[model samples]
Target: MIVTIAGAGHMARGIGNRTLAGGHTLRLYDRTRAKADELAASLGQAASGADVAAVDEGAVAGSDVVVLALPFPAGREVAAAWAGALEGKVVVDISNPVDFSTFDSLVVEPGTSAAEQIAAAAPGARVVKAFNTTFAGPLVTGEVAGRPLDVFVAGDDEAAKRTVSELVSSAGLRPLDVGPLRRARELEGFQFLHMASQERLGLNWSSGIAILP
Candidate 1:
């Protein structure tokens, strides 16, 4: 599979490693070309690193899955700008739109969510909400606490959800299909607490949420 990640920061690096490790070719795009080149270089030969390269944003047109590893508002803009290109493709929205100044509430309207807002902007794309609950630390290894972290997937399209689920499993993590896309409301809210917990309890970004027996 050709996976395109549209960011050059931590989340992109971690997710890029997982994708290359999964044996999928990767195309990375970032406003700063050096960051993407640096990330691809860091993956090294062990991950078939040669298969990954820094590409133009237009390269997303050829990918099977396009990950919007960006903030909520930026993701909305990309979704709108690339709506036609994203048609029938799995577009992963991994943003948590919390009001960082207060962290007490979401920046989205009461009834909708970040993922929903992005979906609205990209009507032609199959939008799926995932990875927001998983912090950047554990994603580097795709595990935490000696256990696989659970990735809650929410999307209206069943086939699209399954595609993301398979990608999650291939990366050695657990994918929990939470429900339709609107369930992203709860996923985002729940992860807001998880993010707050990291700072509140001094977990040092080492914690992850899971569903256990």
Candidate 2:
């Protein structure tokens, strides 16, 4: 599958590396073209390996799956803008809208979540809430605790969830479908605690929340 990651930050690097490791073609895009170019090169140098190339906004239309690896509000903006191009494509929302200043609450409304809001913005796009709980550190290896990283997935469309599930599994990670998109409320809520505890415990970004079965 061809996966296009629409960011050039740490999350983008993590997701891009894993997608490449999964043997999927990757196209990267960022507001700053140079950042995207540098990221693509940093992942690897092989043409077909991981160090593919930076793509433009137009390239997103051709991608099978588009992962919005940006921050909270930014992800929503990009999603809305690309709504037309993302028709029927699996759109992954990996953002946790935490109020960094307060650290006690999220930026979203009481009930809605970033995924849900993004879904609202792009009604035609298949929006899935995932990877928001996973940090960039562990995503590098796509694993934690000697096991694959557990990706919690939530989306209204079962087929979209399945597509993301397959992508997660293919990237050597575990996918946990937590039901419809409404469940994203809890997923986002839980990650706020996870993010808050990151620096508090000085875990050095090594923390991974696992659901032991």
Tell me, by lDDT, which candidate is best: 2
Cα lDDT tens digits for candidate 1, 1-213: 899998888888878888876778888888889988887777755474348889988898899999999987998998999999998889999999998989888899877899999999999999999898888889888899999889999999999999999888898989999999999999999888888777678888868989996
At residue 137, give the lDDT of candidate 1.
87
lDDT of 2 at 207: 73
Clashes of 1: 0
The residue pairs that clash in candidate 2, if any, are none
Per-model lDDT: 0.88, 0.89
- Return the TM-score for candidate 1, rounded to 2 decimals: 0.96
Q: TM-score per candidate, in order? A: 0.96, 0.96
Off by over 4 Å in 2: 46-48
Model 1 scores a C-alpha lDDT of: 0.88
lDDT of 2 by residue, 1-213 (tens): 888999999999888888888888889999899999899888866335453679899988888889999999999999899889988889999999999999999999989899999998888999999999888999899989899999999998899899899989999999999999989999999989888887778877767888999
Error of 1 at 176 (Å): 0.4
